[model samples]
Target: MDEAVKFHFVVDGNDFTSAGQASVQIKKNLRQLGIAPEIIRKVSIAMYEGEINMVIHAGGGEADVLIYENRIEIILTDNGPGIANIDLAMQEGFSTAPDNIRSLGFGAGMGLPNMKRYTDAMQIDSTFGKGTRISMTVNL
Candidate 1:
């Protein structure tokens, strides 16, 4: 692509079955574009973890991915209750998800941490009653 390419996706919070659809699609699209396998894997994993967090806590969100020459940028935004503590939330096992949500095989509190683990850089902007936005980048 001559210019940066953008992809938008709407995450559905009601259904767990469809939570990771966007990430999967992103992976496929990158593959078709001949993106490096390592870069694609890292971005896809980070995006998938972010998507699951939106479903498990935020009730839904919007994800925008920008594909550029040397990097991929992912921005995930949601209108759910904002995270109360970024520092605490980054801990490996910290979680605020309901017990019911935990039972569904999520809420391990690994979402943000895992996202960071896979991406080169990540930042979270959140307000108590407003919402949250996370920006993550995976260098190509």
Candidate 2:
């Protein structure tokens, strides 16, 4: 592709049942484009993790996917309580989810770690009490 193809999705924070919709749609779109299954899987997993984090922590967020010739970029932005410590949040098994969320079998403290693990590149921009913006990329 000579130019990037873009897709935008709005995550509904109030609905746990629809949390992974964006990731699922992205997976379908990638498949239709004939993207490799491995690449699609990586993007789906990363996007899904980010989506769940937004729902459980941020209250909601917007996700944007940009498809490029050499890479795919996923951007998730939320206007909820921002992460206080990026370093700590990146650590595996370190979670701030409440008991209720954990009871739902959703908060395992692995969202950020898993997102980073599946993507080729990842960056998180967050301000305490303000918001967060995470950008991740997967090589094509």
What global local distance difference test value does model 2 have?
Answer: 0.95
TM-score of each prediction? 0.95, 0.97
- lDDT, residue 11, model 2: 99
Overall lDDT per candidate, in order of appearance: 0.92, 0.95
- Give per-residue lDDT, candidate 2, residue 7: 97
User: 15-125, model 1: which lDDT tens digit per residue?
Assistant: 988899999999999999999899989999999999999898789899999999888999999998999999999999999888997888888989899999999999999
Local accuracy of candidate 2 as per-residue lDDT tens digits, 1-140: 37999999999999987899999999999999999999999999999999999999989999999999999999999999999999999999999999988988977889999999999999999999999999999998
- Evaluated at residue 65, the lDDT of candidate 1 is 95
Model 1 TM-score on a 0 to 1 scale: 0.95
User: What's model 1's overall lDDT?
Assistant: 0.92
